[model samples]
Target chain A: AQTVTQSQPEMSVQEAETVTLSCTYDTSESDYYLFWYKQPPSRQMILVIRQEAYKQQNATENRFSVNFQKAAKSFSLKISDSQLGDAAMYFCAYPSITQGGSEKLVFGKGTKLTVNP
Target chain B: GAGVSQSPSNKVTEKGKDVELRCDPISGHTALYWYRQSLGQGLEFLIYFQGNSAPDKSGLPSDRFSAERTGGSVSTLTIQRTQQEDSAVYLCASSLGVLGEETQYFGPGTRLLVL
Candidate 1:
């Protein structure tokens, strides 16, 4: 079984500042995918970034990036130049990718992020 | 191109009653997924459908929960004898195919309340 953990239940950051959300997972599989999803007030989940287990280099998407430490099973999200729009519930997830394509994502309890003006 | 969409954006039913939620995936998408999000909690996988493959119901919490996809396009999640604890937002997502790195686009979700 695979599980993801987000230690922080809630977080807040001032506008223009940077924030980091921590995530850790337990997986016996050597290959997989990790993702950070953002659910805004509209409740539509938006993918923030993704990291491949085999990639030693972390993933970065503009102001959003991940600090992926495979050895530690740690994948954290860093938000730079935080804006009010960034306020949302962020979730860390690991999806099981089977050869048959019958895969499901395991998600951690979310962290509610508040961006202060 | 439209993204995934779920019908009956909000559903209210009494305990012990049955409820059905529908999801319409993006055209040409061969993979569909169902997930439940409790209040202030993260998503819990429910079921998955891909092409002609057998659906994965491993994540279903109980026998009362079941899901079916028609023609690999639209899916329905049915809950028999609903419980108040079943109250949550039911989300639907779809992907182009089963590629390991394909992104799953999500819908706004159907808010189900079992009173």
Candidate 2:
């Protein structure tokens, strides 16, 4: 069983500043996928970004980038130029490629990010 | 209609009552999934449906939770004789099923509150 662990329960970042949410996972398979999902007060799980295990290059989307260290089994999300809208519950997730190929995202206990304005 | 949408946004029922939550996937999306979120439970994988194939019930918490995807577009998740522990936000998501590109688009979840 693969499990994602987010050590930070809550993070505080000033608006226009930067913040990084930490996440780690345990997986025996080397060819899986990892993801970061953001759930705001509206309760919608939005896909922040994703990284494939086989890829060595990190994935970045606009102001969001991931620090994926496959050897260390670490996947952390970094948000630059944070805004007030960035306040939300950020979750780290793992997705298995096998088992019928379902996108069953195993999420970690979220980190409540507070963007101080 | 533009994205995944779930109905009965807020459902409140008694402990022994049954409740049904519906999910309308994106048009033509071949994969649909159900997950539950609670304080300590985090994200609980309930089930997954791909096309018209047999559904995966391995992630279901117990026998009381069942789901069905009709015509591969819409799905209904039912919890019978619900318990207090079953109270959580139920989330549904769908993807294009492009194999390696498994980008899942989620819906605004249905918050289920069992008294």
Candidate 3:
């Protein structure tokens, strides 16, 4: 079974500052997908960014980026120019691709990010 | 709707009672998924459905849980003889296809409370 871990339960960043949330996972599969999802008070899970294990180049989406280290089993999310709108519960996910061409995601305990004004 | 939707937004039921949660996916999506999120915890996969194919129940925690997708556009997760431990937010997601790299769009989720 694959497991994802988010060591930080909560994190805070001042407005205009930057913050990084850490995540790690254990998987024997060489090819898979990693994603970072943001859930706000609205309880909607939004995709923040994603990284493919076969790609060494990190994935970036405007202010949101990811540092993916496949060898170390680490995938961290970096949020730049943090704003109050960025405050949310961030989760790291790994989806297992099965032989039948169907798969499901396995998520880590989330890290609540607070953006302070 | 432009995105996935679930209802009732909040449901409270007594232990041993049966509960059914619904999910409506975006039009044209070929794959749908169900997940359970406990308080202050991450999302756990429950089931997966793809275009008239057999559903995946591998992630279901117990026999009490079952889900089905109708017409491949809407899904319902039913918990028979629900238990207190079943309290959690049930989420639904849909993607254009069942490919591993496809991006999934999520619903707001249904908050289920089994008392």
Provide a comma-separated list of chain B TM-scores, one per candidate. Answer: 0.96, 0.94, 0.95
Q: Write the per-residue lDDT of candidate 2 for residues B19-60, one digit (tens) a residue.
A: 999999999999898989987446888899999999988788
Report the lDDT tens digits of candidate 1 across residue range A79-108. 999999999999999986433446877789
What TM-score, over all chains together, does every model reach?
0.94, 0.94, 0.95
Superposed on all Cα atoms, the candidates' RMSDs to the truth, in angstroms, are 1.9, 1.7, 1.7
Q: Any residue pairs clashing in model 2, and if so which? A: none
Error of 3 at B69 (Å): 1.2
Point to the candidate with the largest DockQ. Answer: 3
In candidate 2, how many Å is residue B82 off? 1.5
Candidate whose lDDT is highest: 3
Clashing pairs in 1: none
Alpha-carbon error at B46 in model 3, in Å? Answer: 0.8
Itemize residue pairs with steric clashes in candidate 3: none
**Candidate 1 interface CA RMSD, Å:** 3.1
Q: Write the per-residue lDDT of candidate 3 for residues B1-115, one digit (tens) a residue.
A: 5899999999999999999999999999989999999998999888889899999887789999999998878899999999999999999999998545688999999999999
True contacts kept of each: 0.63, 0.57, 0.72
Give, for candidate 2 chain A, the lowest lDDT window spanning 10 residues. A95-104
lDDT for each of the candidates? 0.91, 0.90, 0.91
